[model samples]
Target: MTSIEPITLTGKFVTLEPLSQEHHHGLVDAARDGDLWKLWYTSVPTPEGMAAEIDRRLGLQSQGTMVPFATRSNTTGKLIGMTTYMNIDAETPRLEIGSTWNAASAHGTGTNPDSKLLLLRHAFETLGCPAVEFRTHWMNQQSREAIARLGAKQDGVLRNHSRSKDGALRDTVVFSILEHEWPAVRNGLEFRLAKYSA
Candidate 1:
């Protein structure tokens, strides 16, 4: 089983740097842009909770369960969001790319797909992961559509999967891209990103 290490993943639109408390101010500003913490379906951190969020993710990393990153806009060179490779099963070399949220301003700017490209490429090509999973609240229609657009196939829905931030019963929509599907998924991501380049 290969252990996940912290490394910088740079892409054309955004760069994913190992998450740190140093990013506190920038992330607070980013979250404020969208008031992301107010989203009932997501777990984005509030300005006051930014440090705790960073600490929580870092603590998980120490437990060998997650590798979190601060997403920065390459063009603006500022922190715009955070993401992670969580629910790791290093023995099977599998992981779920969850706990991701970007500044509302970064939406539709190719940051999400670009970030995915880096993470997926590393997981499949470098880590030899058999599968990469994604899970989202069933009611988060926007997120569901975005995941589907990535070319991942739906595995199934986990009913009453957990509780949302607002304490609502949540159904988790699970999706995955297997090793064999990476080629096509990569192509789709590269194609989407190419448009941004041109």
Candidate 2:
């Protein structure tokens, strides 16, 4: 599929739409909830920052290195978050789900888990990728725990991986799910969704 084509991936509870201008306003509204970007390790902090972020992601897409999405809750038809496949190695059939942020309403709900299931299904089954990666700041306890719940194995920590927005040195926590591990990961996600729904 052409990278520019509007890709729509839906799971039982969430849908991922290819990032577009139409999604900008809704995402901004969703992000209006406070301190979103205040987290030292998170990418976004304000609605105004989204435009530049969107442009950056689109620029990467032009180079075939990233695909970003505006996450919507299928149940409520509300824009809830954003996610992306970054550092995409199409030749090696691998991509990373990073630069992710969710509205407060999305947390502790089925939105994130189901959103991930939809993306993972596309990455592994549709794209036929051999692996998928999920990375977070090493000290981001919430993100680290969420990644673990996805059944991804912690590969290792990349110390001094990058500079954080706050100018602090970042230690990256890397995790991955190999093709051979998709079955269990998929099942775990389904279970998590079920629990959320129940």
**Whole-model lDDT per candidate:** 0.95, 0.85
Clashing pairs in 1: none
Q: Best lDDT goes to which candidate?
A: 1
Q: Count steric clashes of candidate 2.
A: 2
lDDT minimum window of 10 residues, candidate 1: 189-198
TM-score of decoy 1? 0.98
Error of 1 at 177 (Å): 0.3
Model 1 lDDT tens row, 1-198: 767998999999999999999999999999999899998887899999999999999999999999999999999998999999999988999999999999999999999999999999999999999999999988889999999999999999999989887788999999999999999999999999998851
Error of 2 at 20 (Å): 1.0
Ten residues in sequence with the least summed lDDT for candidate 2: 1-10
Kindly report which residue stretches of model 1 are placed more than 4 angstroms away from their true locations once superposed. none
- Compose the digit string of candidate 2's lDDT tens values, residues 114-194: 888988888888888899999999889999999998999999999999999878899999999999999999998888788
